[model samples]
Target: MPKLNLSQSPAVRAKWEENLKLDSQEKVTSSQQQLPNSAALTPQCIEKRWQVIAERTNKAALLDTDSEKQQNLYSSNIEHFIGTVKLPVGLAGPLLVNGAHAKGEYLVPLATTEAALVASYSRGAKLITEAGGVTALVINEGVTRTPVFEFANVTKAGEFVAWAVTEYEQFKQLAHSTTRYGKLKDININVEGNRVYLVFEYLTGDASGQNMVTFATNTIYQYIIQSCPVDIHSCYLDGNLSGDKKPNSHTMRSVRGKKVVADITIPAALIEKRLHTQVAKMVEFGQMTTTGSLLSGGIGVNAHYANALAALYIACGQDPACVAESSIGITRMEQNAQGDLYASVTLPNLMVGTVGGGTHLPSQKACLDILGLYGSGNARALAEVTAGLCLAGELSIVGAFCAGHFSRAHQRLARR
Candidate 1:
């Protein structure tokens, strides 16, 4: 292919000249028409730009600001902020959680636009609450960050892996040195030819430690570069081995954020009265769905965990994107001898925290406060509630499907 001279093209000449002037630090003549002023598109600048455009377009209320309450919120959290995009946040519960830490009737704030979502969850919450609430257990807690290193050959990569295992204490010390709240818990080694992925798992206290583990891993990476026994050809921060914000089989088996199991046993009579479905039907539905999920080679077998996770995460100031992985889990429904329904959800990766990220935002914090999950020390409680809420949602949605009321309910509520 021949290279075309962009300088000869009038369309490209102006941009090329501007780039050359920028590179050479040459001042353009004042007679030259300057580019529109866009120095750091702050909220003020964005508002001004919108106003100018509105004047030309006869558009009213297009650039209005309802963020008089947000003047103090835009420091480092965001840039180019005009106003907050409002989602219709609805209160769903009085969800009674019988967990190790979270034991109470707490109102769940759910931010969603989907009609009947909150109503469905609320119906489930009522069933659980009346049935003495859902029991939630936090089985494990650890956040992981993986960094990949390349060696000359497989032999060197294997050697590096062995060295990493031996120098675990040193790596832990280096990782822990970066943050006061984060502690290095475990290191997993994965080898592929001349490449090695060092999966660093950490206990990030009170905060969902994506950023925490990243910074800690950077320190460990520096240490590995300085002290590795083998010569490394290249090193990259994440090799997608940590499975951050993506579905992975390992995250489903092992702990990612807070491995939580929530369960509730509803009597046959109550299932008939509340869910309008028999225990046997719900159990059969579970079996069919689970088999279908297994046949599809899915990571977890569940009905719409993302619906609950996303709504709750957004309402409660969590890393909403983490729902991608956090929603991966199993929902089991079994029929007992007495015809009672034993339903449980195992959320192996419920990535949540009470601090950091958008948890401090005004609306998000208010929502967290509604669950009593604001600030520090309530991360475990938050995890438990999150898991319990998920179970409630699954039960409701699955029951809706089983009872053949899913479409009817949507048609009735969603249309309005």
Candidate 2:
């Protein structure tokens, strides 16, 4: 990519500007699914459709490129279940979020004013037309696996890791019920600061398996100590201090050492340096009251809309705790023809459960009830909301920065 100055020609800038347009004209283009963005909900529309759900459960529509195809969009191996919820307020969106587990297009609840933020970002997307798109680099991403306890302090964290990896089958054999958890995949054990954190990955057969993972780990604790040289007396008594929860209730929420980074790539051709600068801002905001630290700015930005979408996540039964890590990631967009960059946003820590926490919360449950996306294994759907939000952040920031009217929209939105 040569650094050619784009200031000389109006034609070139216009071409790039057009490329920067972040138009989701699909709703505008297609005839069948078209409904007013603000149309009142109908009883006929009330009947839930699609295999996966929008993050904002109130808007339960889905768009599967595969939905147009024959083979099941909802996998045969996977099952659909709902715990159901009710919403006290209206949830609106075009909240965009993407996740490893989520594959297609769907709407999500906009937890904040940023819910429809793509519109604002798209405005930026259009201005950078001379530039083309934005870019993204995953400076960081990874999920948290909490502490493991042992009665006696066993020094060899390596030994446990090696054994877990090498003796995988043996550990698999020790389990009394693969029945409860078919999803258990890898066991990662890390020793940091007089404590070891065990992160066990599983292909949980069905549902958001937080409790299932805890139960399985607890069941396996005895086997680890009895077979390995690690001591077990002190760890046995303090339970939550053991698994992915907390070290000691005293320490509260803090993360140290042993992490996994997941990332997505976005083109830099469209949004240019604005892409990098904006994401850095996101990390600066996005507060986590539980941790007393704002979500790092790298991954995405703080959005009123994203907040609203998260509300649906909390209300609908997702792990409200995970939004900290899951919501941050890179937004990349770039231009194919010129040096002008492109953009897309990445969100990493949007952990939502279709089954636990406040999913049963009345307004929350009804909201999920509207989407028919409640209960177990709906994490994928919720993740999409977070991803969509990051994208909205990118579009909003870039479009606003480029067009010179960015502050106007924000001023109006914030005034009331």
| The best candidate in terms of TM-score | 1
Per-residue accuracy of model 2 over 1-416 as CA lDDT, tens digit each: 23335775888776655554434344445544433333223322323322123444643223323232322322322223222322334343433223344433334443333433434544432333323222222222222223365433344555555565666566555543644544455556656554665655554432445555556655566666677665444454123432232222211232211111222333343333444334333332222321332343222333332443345555465555544444343344444354333344444333454545556544456666655556666545444444443455445554455445467766776674
Number of clashes recorded per candidate: 0, 107
| TM agreement with the true structure for every prediction | 0.88, 0.49
C-alpha lDDT of candidate 1 relative to the true structure: 0.86
What tens digits encode model 1's per-residue C-alpha lDDT throughout 61-97?
3333446445456455655444456789988777999
The lDDT of each candidate is: 0.86, 0.42
Error of 1 at 212 (Å): 0.5
TM-score of 1: 0.88
The local distance difference test score of model 2 is: 0.42
